[model samples]
Target chain A: MKSDFYEFFCPVKVISGRQALSNLPHEMDQLNVKRALVVTDKGVAGAGLIRYVEDAFQGSACSIGHIFDETPPDSSNVVVNQVAELFKQKNCDCFVAVGGGSCIDTAKGANIVVTEQTDDLMKFRGAERLKKAMKPLLVVPTTAGTGSEVTLVAVISNVQAGVKMAFTSDRLYPNVAILDPKMTMTMPPKITAATGMDALTHAVEAYYCLQKNPISDSLAITAIKLAMGNLVKCVENGKDEDARLAMANSSLIAGIAFSNSMVGVVHALAHATGGVCHVPHGVANAILLPFGMENNLAKRAGEIGELAQYLCGREIPGDDRAKAEAAIQAVRDINKKLNQMSGLPNRLRDAGVTEDKLEAIAKVAVNDGALIYNPEEVTYEEALEILRRAF
Target chain B: MSQSSNKNDSRGLDSGGLAAAGASAASIYPKAKEPLGMNRLFSLSYPVKRGIARVALLALGAGFEYLSRHCDKLKEEISGWEEGRIFALSILSQGPSVTMKKENGAIRCVGEDLKNAEIVFYFKNIDSALMLFAGFIGAHTASAQHRTIVHGDIGIAMEALRAMNIVQSYLYPGLVLKKTFKRAPKMSFGEKILKAKLMLVLLPGIAAAARR
Candidate 1:
């Protein structure tokens, strides 16, 4: 279905291959920068992934000025200011973010602070609020999900305000995103399964969301096919560089798709679940994707049915509703397989969410900005119903 | 390129010489052309639509103030809001705007005062604002179509949206409501009477607000 009006944009140059990291220094030089601040989390540093980034800079004009590895599982405003302060103190010219969504978002938040020369980030929250050009940012994902690499949005929690501050702008898109198989080669089977499902959810939701357009739909379908083909393989064999690279590409492509098209109920619920229960984002998304699809089935059957070929790997023979059901079932089948393979939880309760928290999660989900783009209206009651069913 | 070079060379001339060159150019150059017919029509329509949008926004603000006093559901919806939390709906870039503040456990229309609004829903242009104000689309559809950009806590925005939905149910007829709202509201006999009352007093309220 074509929309009457839509907008799409992606300016991040993607570099994906076996040794994509080796091109980092050259990319920095292209951006006319010499010293780089490497932002990462302790987990990625602990897993010895920083060495690959360090090795990429060796014998090159650009060098690592500092490595701030204190990024928590969730990026916060405090950490963002800390990173900006370090960027200035270390005299870094650009940022190279290595890790998952947290690291990338932290780097983005810091870029806003550094470029805007503001210690208070709360004033810059919301869409297209950053007027100043950001410092050059290069992202390398150590996980195959959270597609923060290509997205123009960053979520940084304000500890004092007790709310997550979302900053969105075209300027927030990184200058380059490097997808090296070696970076994600260390992901465990469970994390790989979870993150792969996260990418799948991104592609699926982007396809049926209200903002879907021809360009985004094409990218979304390709991403879905790549994820469905490579997710299980990557989970089964973490050493398979081909499958790892494919998943990396899948995540990046899905990120671009959702960044332009935006996501819907699945991400809304997933974010709420993650915020309330401390559940891993991928786990919540993996559990709720099918339910979210089912929630939108009545309004988006045609769009959902179109995903059948990409998700199920074959044309489904039925009406749109039946095909949509098959498409959803295919997702469930993948989840079930991942559960058997890596114990990825297939239900919210099993993923550490208690039944009592469903209502609170529903309340938060209704307030999520992503819900605005949902094809079907998701009120508090509808959101609660979806949560109950997923639970 | 030669003309541009000549203009650049003129920059080196004295002020009197420059003024004389400018006068000569003004006399030599053709008068500015009138806008194309279609462009002229569009320019003419802009103010008409902007006027309609402005009147609609004033009525909307007045309606919120009226319903906050009479509508129970609206009252309940807004009761949880913190005191003095200001929100606004406005067209972008120097367009007429309306701000509402939660005060004394009720919503009060604060007119176009946007200085202290904690949350703002900015329609990208007058056309988008006219779409919603003219009842051509609902709030949910407006948001889904990306006709508006919200700047604030999304949770508070959603709360404001719910309240706006309630006010809309009373302001618009049932047929228009059916077309615009995601779920058409069902009003009781007393509520219907309240709606009738609101219809009677709304124009006068808008007039009073406009006068202010």
Candidate 2:
């Protein structure tokens, strides 16, 4: 299953298990960092999860220079600028991102600003365009979704311009990704369910996208299997350390897979929804995964059929097309189960996406860069249809 | 959420908004001194950007020439192809075009004349072309993204795509080939020797071409 020609790169050092957070100071010391700026939201700090990270730094050569716990749920250019200022003011030489995607991306954006000595990040937007390596960054993701830790791209909203500028580069990969069960054990079941589904969408899209290759496909399959086996258990009992660790590993694996291969219309549509209506990214992705899978079924039935067995835990009896439909149905069943367990909304309407905004979301989705990797050509009207169906 | 009427926002600059800024980037030489039609600012410094594109395109052309001469895959792909078959790879609405034509079963660069080109792959923007040359994105993915347009026979375009893929297999490292190609070839001992020979000659030839 080797592709004719393909390249795979993941330079991020990963450490996962109990008390993985304790290695953060040692990892930072290896990177020769002296002072670190910790980026997280008020919620993570309020939940006392940041205490573990703070405790990890005690007696280590690497010290916390500042704790900027003001990141909003949605990362913005303003937050990035503020974080950069804090880094400079505190004379921090490294970043410790200790929350979900927003905090991680905010640190990434600020890293670009400080290292590149530019106030504006938009100049570095797009793929592999940066010239200088970002300052050392280590991510400890509190949520088991978004995979922002290992991903090479960061999305920061520019509310003034009404656009979310995406910055991508090989240099953006965090120097280390530390996954600790204690960090995610405190997440509400709803957030847990939504983020786990986000990981699933990333895996499914990586397998079916145009950039699919053997290596990425292998990682994606493993991620899907892990998610299928552990996401529900983690949701049902958040304290189950094994389930939490598996889900964490699944999110990281899926992150690496999709970051290399890229995601498709599901991300495009979900990103647009997050932009227009302020829906949570994972929630939007969770609602739209089945609809997006159905849209791609025609061009990618063989891959979808294979996915059916991974998801449903049994061989489906049918042709490729029939099995693809069965895979889509398995996703729908999973969504319902998540809803029953954690009250995760299964439809756009339930997620608070107004009908009037579907057209706007469709318009933005068609222009998303993710559309380039989609198996099928998606038009604005067709995107609208998917939205309506998901609604 | 009030919209600002000012010409620029805090997100640095969008290519489309540059008309008001008085810094328009024109293509390299042999074309009009007008701004890039697609309006993307070249991210690299101008001298470095132009030099990189020139050398990369020259290497690509020389690689094709070498493949045409020594590679069996190339021969099989273009076997029975009529003479005077020309293909141009160009960024749409700009310069830096490279056209190659089949002459006596070998490929040679024909400069930037579209009239002789039966097939042309046009990048929608300068950014897209630069990204492709930088190996940041694959050709097939670029096409799917509407970043490219093919002008000519659909059948020939498909053939050209296959041929380009073959040349790429010989030119790029196995790792890059694995990333870019749908299926990377398993090279034989002779094929590996041929690729080594091609690289030895192609690198200097591209350097010479770029100097000119």
Candidate 3:
């Protein structure tokens, strides 16, 4: 459906396949990169997935200048500053972000600081603030989820301020995303299930959020179908290359979809919950997706109903309202199956959300920028109600 | 703002001499004779558009003052809000920002310069603001188009949006309200009297404020 006015853009050149990592050096040549800084977490390096990125650069003009593998699960501003300093010290011409969202976001934040020549990223926070073109960044996500390689926004936690600072600008989009299935093949069942569900949530929210338009709607539907078909198989059998590649594509497509259309209350609440209790982002989304949809059902029932068709692979038996309810049920069923198969958390309490912190989480959730894109207005009381229900 | 206006006036007129000459020779020039596209129409001398926006924001501020004083719904919605809570609605990098504050239990405009606004509603482009100021679209519709960004506490922003909706219900006609509001206000008999009373007080007050 067409809105009266809307804007959509995704400029990241995505290269996906079994041997896609081999194309990284050629892509680097396209970006005119020489020495590259490799950013990854200890977890990804431990899994030996960094080798795929390192090995891709062999026999090419571009070489890895330094490896900063200390990225935490939550990328922090302090870490970003350190990475930028290292990039400058090594005289690296580009960044090759490995691992998931945190590594990618750290590189993104560092890129802004390096190119803009600002020591404090706090001054350049918010949307469309960075005006200059950043150094070329090529992302090789070790996980199938987050899709951060293509996203134009980065969330880096400020350790001093105890807040997550989000940097959004067109300049943040990486020059290339090399999705090699081998990189994600090392993910365990639990991470696979959680990340898959996170991609599913992204597609679902993008399909029904206030910003939904024809282009995003089409991409979101395809992402939903791809994720629903491949997430379970990939979780059950991690070495299933086809399933891993499919889920990777789903995550990438869903990343593009939500990047343009944006997510709704689910992401808002999930972000707050993550900020408060340190829950992983994908697990929070996996826990809260259905509940978030239920909250918006009143205003977006017809749209939610349409998602049931994607999930069920057929027309659901009911009117728009009933189909919407069925869609909620379908999400619940998927959650249960994912939990049974891969031990993914199906409730907020299971995800370590304490009952006492619900009020605080609710207070913070209401302030998230994503709330502006929610289909229905969410008040504090309503946010608390959703938290309690999810709990 | 004035500095930017002077710069624009200089650039748009290509120095004062040509601008005066263009005004005099506007009828003879083919470029001047061309039908104005939407962008061209809005690209009127920046200072003039900026002036229109200032008046529109002031009028909107006065409208909020009336609604805050007379509308019981708005009062109830904003009840228990802090005394000095500030909000800013702006067109980013183009138009001026309008700041509003809660003073003496009602929201009123402070000035064009944004102070310590706890909440900010930003339009990414001036075209979005133009469409909205021209009443071609409503707040919810604008939001749907990804034309608005809320900075600061979103809960408080929603409350302010609700208050804006209440003000719109009273300020615009039923047809506009029907399109804009999810559930347009159905005023009771006493509420109708309150609306009438508020309008009687507002017209003179708005005129005075606009004049000043």
Clashing pairs in 3: none
Q: Residue by residue across B42-133, what tens digits does model 2's lDDT show?
A: 65665565566666678888888778888988988787568989997876575477788999988877666777686777776667777667
Instruction: Give the C-alpha lDDT of model 3.
Output: 0.83
Q: Which candidate should be chosen as best, given TM-score against the real structure?
A: 1
Please compute the TM-score of chain B alone for each predicted structure, in the order given.
0.78, 0.75, 0.70
Please report, as a residue range, the 10-residue window in candidate 3 chain A with the lowest summed lDDT: A1-10
* B1-212: candidate 3 lDDT, tens digit per residue: 67866776778756665766666554322231222254664677767767666666666677778778777888987786889888878877768777778999998777766658777788877777765665556787687676776665445676777777777666666675665554567878887776677667666765655554
DockQ metric for all predictions: 0.19, 0.04, 0.14
* lDDT, candidates in the order shown: 0.89, 0.83, 0.83
lDDT at A225 for candidate 1?
A: 92
DockQ-based class of model 3: incorrect
lDDT (tens digit, per residue) of candidate 2 on A290-309: 89998988778988888999
Q: What digit string (tens of lDDT, one per residue) describes model 1 on residues A211-263?
A: 77767888999999999999999999999999999999999999999998889
* Candidate 3 per-residue lDDT over residues A1-391, each given as its tens digit: 1353588989999999989999988998898889999999999999998787788888998898999999988888899999999999999999999889999999999999899898777656666668898999999988877879889999888788666778777889999998888999989899998899889999999999877776888999999999989998998899999999999999999999999888999999998898889888899998899999999888888889989998877789879899998888888888899899988898899999899999999978877878877877787899999999999
For every candidate, C-alpha RMSD to the true structure in Å: 10.9, 19.1, 11.1
What stretches of model 1 exceed 4 Å from their correct place? B1-44
lDDT agreement of model 2 with the native:
0.83
- What DockQ does predicted model 3 obtain? 0.14
